[model samples]
Target chain A: MILLFLSSGLFLGWSLGANDAANIFGTAVATRMVRFKTAAITSGFFVIAGAVLAGGGATRTLGQLGSVNAMAGAFMVALAAALAVLWMTRAGLPVSVSQAIVGGIIGWNLFTGSPTSIDSLVKIVSTWVICPLLSAVFAAGLYVLARAVTQRSRMHLLAEDAMTRAALMAVGAFGAFSLGANNISNVMGVFVSAIPASSVHLFGFLHVSSDQQLFALGGIAIAIGIFTYSYRVMITVGKGLFRLTPVTALVVILSESLVLFLFASESLEAWLISRGLPSIPLVPVSSSQAVIGAVVGIALVKGGRNLDLRLFRRIAGGWVATPIIAASIAFFGLFFLQNVFDLPVHRPVVYELSDAGIERLRERGVDDEGLAELGGVAFKSARGLTGVLREKTSLGMIDRDVVVDCARRERFVVTRKRIDTLDLKLLTVGQIRALRDITGQEFNYWWELESTLTRESDQWAMLPDTRDNHPANKKLRSNLRQLLDAFRTVDTDD
Target chain B: MANLFARTRLLESKIDEYLNHTSEVGLLFREAMKNFLDGRLDEFEERRGKVCDLENHADELRREVERQLYIETLIPESRGDVLGLLEQTDDVINHVKHALMQVSVENPDIPDELGESYLELADYGSRAVQELVMGVRAFFRNTAAVPDHAHKVAFWEKEADKVAERLKRRIFQLNIDLSHKIQLGDFVMHVDSIADQAEDVSERLSISTIKRSI
Candidate 1:
């Protein structure tokens, strides 16, 4: 059953809630301004709401890193990442699920011999660096702003205290919401490719897609984690960071929420695109890093002399180590899952060099002399296709590239009618609108249609891309127009 | 959990006890000064011993409070503030003990003309300390009243300072040895410092109250 395979993802989600929830409400709860029970309940509710609502946006970028096409593979990847997080947490070291899951996905790619998209990898790595820096900037700005407002109000001390307590709770809830939106992908993202794109009807009234159901399940697991295990971590984080003033705590939480929101908000990205401006990537970022960055921002604003530089360095060291440790665990865990447990980790994907593959190769400028002899040939994997092509022809060094492209061509299954009937429930409203705008556009292949849809889709265009304009997107549009004209002329000849 | 909570409550009460014990230092100083002015060294020593005993009791309570603050995590959120307040408040008691010890050891040659002034100075300092003690209690029980008590402490401190200045001027004009005059002046400064320290502690109490309110 899929439930068995889902256990690892659920476990990862739980750990994420246990660890990251502290970043949101730790200062308030530890300072006793907000009761722990109240903080936990509010966090549990908002985090799930956030995950169910906006969690899907960042999953596509994670899918680009590596598509673990089998449920078993996704299980092992999530398991390895979760184990890594648990171990680091027990060791009293800071670890983030975002970094661990990225490492796990990369390990799965390596184990399965899938080509890692360097573009996605670079984008993810860069965001890891930028997320914290952006948080620091936002935190510094917020700290100054909060100080000015409080000073200007000049309220009675008790009134100011009450206001600060209320603000901390409000900002903490917002931070929890942003955290769920950002980090849910790290928990449930590996299964994105494995989740079926069809909705299941429940009691003839509620229709839930596999993606939504999986996200909801992950959200619930996260909620359970927050309610059960977050208090101790909250205490540690709250006390470990410099003793936070109520105002400083509010500023740190607001800054963290803003950073996570910027990274995960599809609405903001869409607005940026509507204005013809480049949009922010919907990437799941580390909330722990963001919170630490905000605290550092406060320390800097407070003259930077009292910062626990040693603790900062240790935490920084842990950040560097988390991903590498997770990757190693995933890499080795894959072999154990596939061999020892005999699970179907990498599915057997077949590519045929039939008329379709040949036509695609010709369009790609492959030499046509010996390609006819390759008709009806089948390959079980990308390497198999490349090896067979190299053996059968005197093709030069680019033979593997051609075979890889041909294998990719085999993946396109979209048609005009299929795009017309494509499930809107599975897509954001912006994506649905983008698909509608491109209706009746002639595309011979699904890849062409998907790329066109992606370019037009506000959420997709803003996705973090390492390559400038991502060469694949540019080529898809050009090839689709050429193929459409060729189809037109051939119809006239007929 | 309830036990720990009760233990913290008990620790806070002990700290209040310490404050009460330290407050008696002012009363003891007045008593010891009376016996000293009356040439009753034996009586003064008896009361001085009582002051020392109270000081020791306060020290023990302070240590217990500090231990519980660490071990039981009493008032964890404001533990530092409580400890800082305790440490600073203890300084007033130490000043009381030192002033009394100096008077006993030095055996100041108080002229009959200055005996009433000496007693007046002691009375003024003791009253200021009592106000400070009340302010400290208010810091723990009724924060709003702390500033008022601190104001009262400032009033007594100013009165005590004026008495000290008058005593110094009269002692200098007594045709006593320059060294005796300086020693008496030193005694005057030391005794007046008790009120000054109480005012300082009350200022701290005000700040601590403000911190809690905010």
Candidate 2:
């Protein structure tokens, strides 16, 4: 059953590998600078390494957009995204898995009546534009530097060829690694919430979390896709669109890799925050768009004689068309899955402005007087509560989100069985002790359980979101989210 | 990695050696002509034999370099251009050898006044060939320098043409048989054709350099 549910995500992962691997290794293989076998093996190994190691950052951002929250719903969403990509690929239009998956999540949100976080959506959609533009800038700068070096060095032609070949291989590997890190979220991120949390001990020593295991499976699927299908795409990409010399190909790959790395690297973001610098958001971006941007960048550096405005318009059209198509497919697919197949597409969450929720909203500085009128009324969905919040109170979007979150009624019971299921290795001694102290307690909301734990132990409390405490706060939040997921009881009464 | 660089260096040296053979053929051709004009037939024959040997050696080296380039897939974008350059330059060497062989086969009796002019024509042909080799070398290392050497090749070829015309005019005015004058004129044209071949190679080198520029 687990395999059946995960098949759609694996298919999505396969398609992602088939299409995006070309952006990394196309010119090198087409030009015979690097053999296809070498490229495949190097990329396959590094992609898996990257997915297991650095995939968490982009996955977290995707989770923020919309948590699918049910296995069958995740299956339909991933299936919809995969079908959209396959249709676009057959139609010979530019398509992105990241965009399609975002649309699928939005479709799921609409069907389940979940309020999609506007802040997360805006951040993700903005990257669709910014990602390509940034790649163009990086490519242009690198081109100038490469040309200057080749000219000033006066190296023999054969020696330069040898060096360029080696550089292409090295950069191709880095590009593959970055691609795996950034785009794994698109392939397996929905399944992250649907799958139950567990950890496995490998070789009796190395600990592997459930999320890592899922990502690794997705990575293997991507590798299979690369091995089975990407060669033809790489060849076509080499012959298609812009004609790239080996050196120019190197520049394009490097620029694309850098952009993917900037968006997907958690450590880089953390390091930048530690130094008080602005950090780039971890988002999965389109590798194909990045490749096109890089090619255009080189064309511009060469005076823009080869710029094709028609092709650009077509690609932009795809960026708009792919998401809408994916969303529609997901919406209809979910309806069929629920009606015909009798599947539970969503674990419905209920909201209510109880006295405790009202007090919590007031503590958070919200004007709760208007919310008091709606107290004790159980809303069927977050959108329903949001609608009432807008009608009754003049609250802003962020505050409304806070109100909805605080008013969400999730019953978390602290029992010995649930406490035993927690990964003791991931929690501090204080946190485990606090869990033991609250073994018999029950709460009507996630935040109530969180507050009880904070009162019992400082380890359960989040630190101020300062530069020094950012990582700690992030870890605390993750730990708290895990505990919440572990102890929550499903409300089946609709 | 070191092996890759070492292989490239070896190929570079082999190409250098082939170009050297071409330049050496030009020098031997000029010396053989000088010896023939100075009435040293034995020395002329010896230099002619050496020119033939160098031409054969250059052909073998060029073939090896071409094979290595294709096998290793080096400079894929410019490989065709480089091969064309090498073959055209080799044609110049073959021209020198043919011109020398013609002089040996058609041992025409030369008037004393025309001997110095003939030597001067051979000098210009040799210089043109040398300049063309430099242009080809610059195409490989410093494309910016190729035009300079190509321009020098054209200059020397023009000088050879002028010397050939004057020698032919002087031969026609000589108090000799019409058959002999025409034969000497044919010899002068043959030697001047060597410089013409160099000019053609230089022209090709110029275009190749433009293509190779980043």
Provide a comma-separated list of chain B TM-scores, one per candidate.
0.95, 0.97
Candidate 1's DockQ is: 0.08
Each prediction's whole-model lDDT (CA) = 0.77, 0.88
lDDT (10s digit) by residue, model 1, range A1-494: 68888899999999998999888999888887677899999999889888878786687678767777788889988998999899889878766889899988888877876656667788888888898888898998898887777656644333344566667778888888888888888999888666444346779757665566778889899999999899999988888655877777888889999999988887777667656677787788999889889888878986896788998888888787888888888889889988998987876555556566677577757765666776676666666666666777777755555545555432233334444333345455775566557655664344455557668864545334444444434333333322222222112132
Segments of candidate 1 deviating more than 4 angstroms: A201-207, A351-406, A409-494, B1-195, B202-214
lDDT of 2 by residue, A66-184 (tens): 98989999999999999999988887765689999999999999998887888999999999999999999999999999888887788888888899888998898899999999999
Question: Model 1, residue B192: what's the lDDT?
Answer: 94
lDDT (10s digit) by residue, model 1, range B1-214: 3454455457667877998887788888888999999999999999989988998889899998898667743344556777877787788788878988998889888899999999999999999988888887766656667789999999999999999998999998989899999999999998998899888877777777766642
Query: Candidate 1 at residue B127, lDDT?
Result: 94
| DockQ for every prediction shown | 0.08, 0.62
* Native contacts recovered, each model: 0.04, 0.56
Docking class of 1: incorrect
Distance from true position, residue A34, model 1, in Å? Answer: 1.5
Output the worst ten-in-a-row residue range by lDDT, candidate 2 chain A. A485-494
